[model samples]
Target: MTRTLVVIGHGMTGHRLVDTVRDLDPAGHWRVVVLAEERDPAYDRVRLSAYLEGHSRTELSLVEPDFLTDPRVDLYTARPAVHVDRKTRTVRTADGDEIGYDALVLATGSRPFVPPVPGRELRNCFVQRTLDDVDALRAAVRGGQPAVVIGGGLLGIEAAHGLRLLGMQPHIVEFAPHLMPTQLDADAARVLQRGATALGLRLHCGTAVTSVDAGPDDAVRSVTLANGTVLDTDLVVFAAGIRPRDDLAVTPDLERGERGGFLVDAYCRTADEHIWAVGECAAVLGRCHGLIAPGYRMAESVARQLTDHPAEPFDGTDTSTTLKLLGVHVATFGTMPVRDSQAVEVTFAEGTTRYAKVFLQTSTGTLLGGILAGKTGSRTELTPHVGRRPPADLEQLLLPD
Candidate 1:
């Protein structure tokens, strides 16, 4: 008899799980059901900023033309799994439909974290997350309008670029002293700052938004900073961070991580043996893996478990990133939050364009981590050497040829 597998939250990771299971269980051992809250199917959220560059919804889709039409797969669009009845092995949808399943997987991703500043709910204030978000931003933004983006992380920079592409004067406000504070060191951030400024992005580093002031119509007029300076803008985009969508994991039996993700074991299984979780919603070892690679890995691992295939335990993954923002390349990999004394730091920079830094164990020449800006070829080459002693000279590795 074929077992039924119900997957909630049909985002990128959820799609990966379905594809993996379908490929491994070719004998039709498990029938699949997917619940997607979004009207559109799974799309490449990594390239969400491309919407500003003339890319349509169809261009960014991760779903294949035939994947949804599979006989064994039942997809419900715009229907979210509102509640899970684990005792009866049933999932209740937002439309009051109850679907039964033998096994359930939660891949409910994350949502943009909007700060609780005053006037944040005003019109023209937005957060970068889904296609609807970008579309709404485009509708609100006009040519030559001033725009302010809060938080100078990856998403913040991407929002700035996207606004600039739409002909808006984009300004970035970051509480941290440097841009991409979590990924780039000060030296690399300086170079990236120069690149971003060259693209007409005005940045206000080391500043926090105290409040967003609105006009008489209750629309975003300006943003007040912690330093008593108010920036005039027509639109405000918040790209501070993300919080996991762990509402579905609130059942008494299911456990949750401290940071608001579904608590899962080594195999991405929740406390209940029949339930598993993957992606931002699931927390493994008490922390959520928000990146794509780790989430994909979890999806694959869970699929193997369901198919009775030999699978390795889902340990942690390398939190590496490589992307271009405003035409500037930025890459960071491995352990980046180490203390100065923990590893020997080697850096290379050329003017305000290129910057590179590598952390290594000086005694054994073992690579620990690295950050690269303006160039990223080294990231791909050096990633494999992480935790392993490299054959080449450390200084030569840091320098770009």
Candidate 2:
């Protein structure tokens, strides 16, 4: 007899779980049912900013037409799961429908963190997370206007770039002392700042928005900073951070992480033996990884467990990141040493256009971690060598040929 596997929230990781399960169990050992809150199917959220570049929705879609046509699979779009009855092993949807399952998976993902400030609920304030959010922003904004984006992290920078592409003057406001503070040091951020300013973006670092003031029409008129500076703008976009969607775990029996997200073991299994969680919603060993790669690994692990195959426990994940922001190349991988006592450090810089740094173990020549700013030609070659020894020409690894 085939068991019923119910998955909630069909985002990127959720889709991956369903896809992986079907591939491993071609014999139809599990009947899959997916409940997606979004009207559209899973899409490439990592490239969501491309939509601002006039890319159509279909271009971002990750699903093939025939992928969901399997007789054993059932997909319900625009349906959100509201409650989980672990006792009966059933999930209740907002539409008054309850679905029974032999096993359950939560891939609810995350939501953009909007800081609690005065007038945040006013019109024209947006959070860039989904296709609908982008569409709403594009429709509400006008060209040649000034817009303020809260946060200077990766998502905030991407939001500012998208707004600039729409012909709006974008200003970034971050509480950190420098841009990409989580990934880059102050010096590397200066290089990034130079590149961003060259593109006409305004930066306001080390400051927080105190309030978002509204105009006479109740639309956003201006935002006041904690430092007493006021930025006059009609729009405000918040990309400060993300918080996992773990509200469905209402019962105290369902443990949650200290930061947020459903608490699960290394195998992605929750406290309940029959229920598991993957993606941003699953806090494996008290930590939740916001990146897509870790979520994919979690999905694969859960798929293996359900298939009764030998599976390895998820000990940890590579937080390394490589990406282009505002036409500037940047990458950071492995463990970044904070003090001289930790590891031997090597550094190089070429004016304000290029900067590189690497940390190596003192005892062994093994690469610890590194950061690249302005140009990342060596990122592809150096990333794989993290936690291991690199080529003899360590100097050449920091510079482009």
Candidate 3:
């Protein structure tokens, strides 16, 4: 007898879970059922900004043509799981459909966090999350119009770049003193700032948006900063941060992390033995990692367990990031030391274009973490040697060959 596996949410991580399970149990030991909230199937959200560059929805899709046609897999799109009946081991969808499961997994993912500011719900305001969001933004925007993007994080920068691509003049407003504060130090952020300015992006760092003002037509017109500076614009985009989509887990009385997300163990198992969670919704070991890499690992771990295969516990995640922002290359890896006393800091800079910094243990030569801006040719070589000591030629690791 084959057991039924019900997966809630069909985002990138959820799709990976289903694919992995099918690979492990080709004999159909566990039949898979996926409940997707979106009308369209899973797409490459990591490259979501590419949609702004004229990439069609089909181009962004992560699903293979024949993958969903598998006999053992049942996919229900635009069906969001509304309730989890823990006692009955069942899930209730918003469309009034109920499905029973021998094992259940929640991959509800996350939502963009919009700040509580007046006029935020105005017509031209948007958040970058799904294909529909980018579509809406594309339709609303007019070339050469001004746009204000709140938050200077990765998502915010990406949204700003997309706005630039749409021929809109984007002004980035960040509460932090520098750009990419989570990933880069003040000096590195300066280098990044230079690149963004060169791309015609206006940045307002160390300020918060006090309110989003609207025009007489109730459409977003301008934003007032905490520092009394007001930026007139036709669009307002919120990319501040993300919060887990764990509302459905509330009725089940599932434990949640302190920051948010359904609390789960290293195995991605919740309090209920039969139910598991992966992706942004699952707070494995009291921490919720927003990156796709950790989410994919969690999905694979859950898939292996359901297949009765040996799997390693998810102890932690690699928070390393490497990407291009506004035509500038940036990379950050390993643990960044906060104080100078903790680790030895080595930095190299070249004419406001290239900057590289590495932190090494004070007692040992072990690499703690590093930041690369402009030129990131060494990122691939240096990332792997993060916890370990690098070769004797340390200069070779810092510069491009």
What lDDT would each prediction earn against the true structure?
0.87, 0.89, 0.89
lDDT of 2 by residue, 364-395 (tens): 97898888998645676887788788777766
After superposing all C-alphas onto the true structure, candidate 2 shows an RMSD in angstroms of 1.7
lDDT of 3 by residue, 206-256 (tens): 999999998999998899999999999989999998999988843558988
Q: State model 1's lDDT.
A: 0.87
Model 1 quality (TM-score) = 0.96
RMSD to the true structure for each prediction, in A, is 1.7, 1.7, 1.6
Query: Which should have the higher lDDT, number 1 or number 2?
Result: 2
lDDT of 1 by residue, 1-401 (tens): 98899999889999999999999998998999999999999998888888866699999999896797788899989999889988889999989998889999999999999999998999999998999988888888799989999989988988889888889999999999999887778888987898888889999999899999999899999999999989999899999988999877335568789988989888898888889989998889788986888899999999999999998888674688887777788888876745856678877777777888878886777878888888545677778889997556655665657
Off by over 4 Å in 3: 337-342
**Lowest-sum lDDT 10-residue window in model 2:** 246-255
